[model samples]
Target: MYLHSVAAYLPAAIIDNAHFTRLNGLADEWIIERTGIRERRKAAPGENSNTMAIAATDAVLAQAPAFAADSIDLIVVGTYTPHDTIFTAAHAVQRHLGINEIPTVSISSACSSLLNAVEIVEGYFAMNKARRALVVVSEHNTAYNNEEDTIAGHLWGDGAAALLISKDRMSPADLLIREVVTGGAAPVSKADEAVTLKPVERGIVMPFGRDVFQQACTYMARVTQTLLDKHHIPNQELTYLIPHQANLRISLNVAKQLGLAPERAVSNIERLGNTGCAGAAIALAEVWDTIKAGNKVIVTVFGGGYSYGAMLLERN
Candidate 1:
């Protein structure tokens, strides 16, 4: 399957590192040193994950004029933050897009949601179940975050991104996915509550920063390298390495271990922070026009559930 188009919509409100420093009584430089995030976007009141997803889906649909709404037989929304638990984000997107009732599903794999959605879409195409598919990801980090809590507040942002995939090649594809792989293993040692979000709670609990950092880097690198090795693609051939926008350090460390140049890794964490499921997709949309035809791009992701995956693609 090929990505016909991709688009992103970020909230207008900007929360810089200084805001977190002021609330938590930490130095501005300390936030930067730890997360490498200078600022992030927060959705205003009345703006939630579903609204952002609709906006992003509208933008993607507008871009792909050749693919009509009626042709979309599949809709997949990857998000942990939902406006309501009763209705899936995909259903709302389909309704707003004026498309008929189709096979719509919601994925809640935290950061790896988008990658997992792509994998599902690929399966639909391979099975000849969908001629065209719509994938949307909305992340409202501010909605569930506790600003008073120092750790999670500063590391997250709010945003949404959409991708239109098709087997018919309705328009010039942004990239043709060469291969996708996703898997994860439990921690060998006793696990701590590194991250948790309950339906009744306002936000998630994220302690054990050191453990999360170590595991994130290890699994992300492992999944990325496995995909590359399986396809016999050298690290040097990758035009850009887009890892989950969890932290700048993790992206840089993965690149360093793979012997990739610092410039080859695509990163927007310094500006947009970690946008959960929308991170990699947003990064790709920001650099879509700059990626020349035939350029190879690899997106590796690790989410809160200890799930991780990687996808290798080439601009068409």
Candidate 2:
């Protein structure tokens, strides 16, 4: 499918490294050196996953003025942090976008949710079930963070990202998702104790930092290389490696394993922190303008639930 436009919404509250420093008595440089995150955005009161998704979708539609609201026949929201348990974020987004009676899907595969959402959109197009679709990912990481935990409490932020995917080109210069690959050999479920963001007495649990870190690098590198190999696209041909913005070290290690320079990878973790499902999309939206036409960009994501995937995109 062709990507019409991309947009993102980052909350205004900036939580810098100093917040963690004061909270845990760790040096500012220590956090950066460990996670490569200097600061991240946190949602303010009243801002949640649905609101952020609406903001991002509005921005995307504004960018592609010709793509009417009625044209969208499918909507997929990739999120682990939903505003309401009874109503999916996709329901809220569809209502706000003013589209009616279309099929809306909510996916919660942790970090790979965004890529998985795109994969779903691709499947609909391949089945001739949808001509136009909107895929959005939003996460309110701070809301579930265990504030007492030093390792994960300060490592998360909140943001949303949206993308317009269609079988037909919305613009002549649109980018195409040329290839996709998903799943893995890793036992992500067994590593569940290492990483989590689920209900635990009105809050969320987190991963054991050391265990989570080790597993992340291994799976991220494996899934990324799996996608590249499927397309027979050499590492040298990849113009950009956009991995989930969970950690700087994991991204760098994936690049190294793939035989690509770290500069070829795009990252916003230092400033935006981990936006969960929204990480790759938000990071991609921020640097969309810089990617040259015809350049090959690979987006690889590994998230909680042991979920992971990758996509090969080429700017048209």
Candidate 3:
């Protein structure tokens, strides 16, 4: 199926590298070198998931006026940081937009957050479960960052984006999808940081840079190749490739190893840092601004759970 339209909202607040370093006890050089991020967005203090989701959905729905807000059959909000544990971001967006009759749910997969969100939507369309759907993913937690967790702190930013998908726009042979393969070797966290922090705690945690890079590159590359081989789709024909905006080092390394030219890879990491779930979705939304009618798109993401996924789709 085709992505009917995409839209995003980066709040007015822009935090620069020097400010980040000074405020969080990090060095501009170290953060940039490791993550290829100079600066990223931080939502205003009063802003929360509900408000941002409304703004994001307004923008996304506007771009697809061909479909009405009432036509949305599914709303999947992929996120880790939420205003409250009880209020799912999807439901928040639904209520904000006055479209509460649809099915809504939240999915969290760390860096693979939005990718998993996309996969869920794909299933709905594939099974004739939904005609039109909206995927809203964002992170709104810069103030909640852990001071000691420098790695996660220095890399994350807050922003939200939405993607509108519809069946009417999809072409019969579009790389709609052949198969999806998932693999994560083991647990990165004990799921019991209670002695220190709760497993469900949404705040940042100090991540081992070396360990993250190793896990990301291995899992991303393996999953991507497995999907490619399974679909009989070659690596050379991919027109666009978007990776989870974890770090430019990890992104480029995966592309280089996968035989995709440097230009084929798309990134906003340098500018937006790691936007949690919205990383890959925002990257695709940015590219959507210039996409032609029938381009090939291959989206692969390596995320927070130490998880990774790949989707091979063609433009309608």
Residue 6 in model 2: lDDT: 91
Q: Is candidate 1 or candidate 3 better by TM-score?
A: 1
Residue 231 miss distance in model 1 (angstroms): 1.6
lDDT of each: 0.85, 0.85, 0.74
lDDT of 3 by residue, 230-265 (tens): 767688877777877878998899889889998888
Clashing pairs in 2: 194-207
Who is ahead in lDDT, 1 or 3? 1
lDDT of 1 by residue, 1-316 (tens): 7888899999999988778767888677988888888999999999998999999998988877886778889999999988877687888898897777678988888788888999999888889888789999999888888888877767889999999888765556457888889875445331336777775855866786677777888888888888888888887888899999988998898888888998888999999988998999999998888888878899999877687899988876
Question: How well is each residue in 1-316 modelled by candidate 2, as lDDT tens digits?
Answer: 8988899999999988888778778678888888998999999999999899999999999988877878999999988888886688899999997888888999888888888898899889989999999999999888888656776777888999999999987776789888778774346545656666557555556657666667777877887788778888888999999999988998998889889999988999999988898999988898888888878888988877677788888986
Winner by TM-score: 1
Residue ranges of candidate 2 with Cα displaced over 4 Å? 184-189, 200-202
TM of each candidate vs. truth: 0.96, 0.95, 0.88
Question: What is candidate 3's local distance difference test score?
Answer: 0.74
Cα error, candidate 2, residue 136 (Å):
0.5
In angstroms, give how far residue 85 of model 2 lies from its true place.
1.6
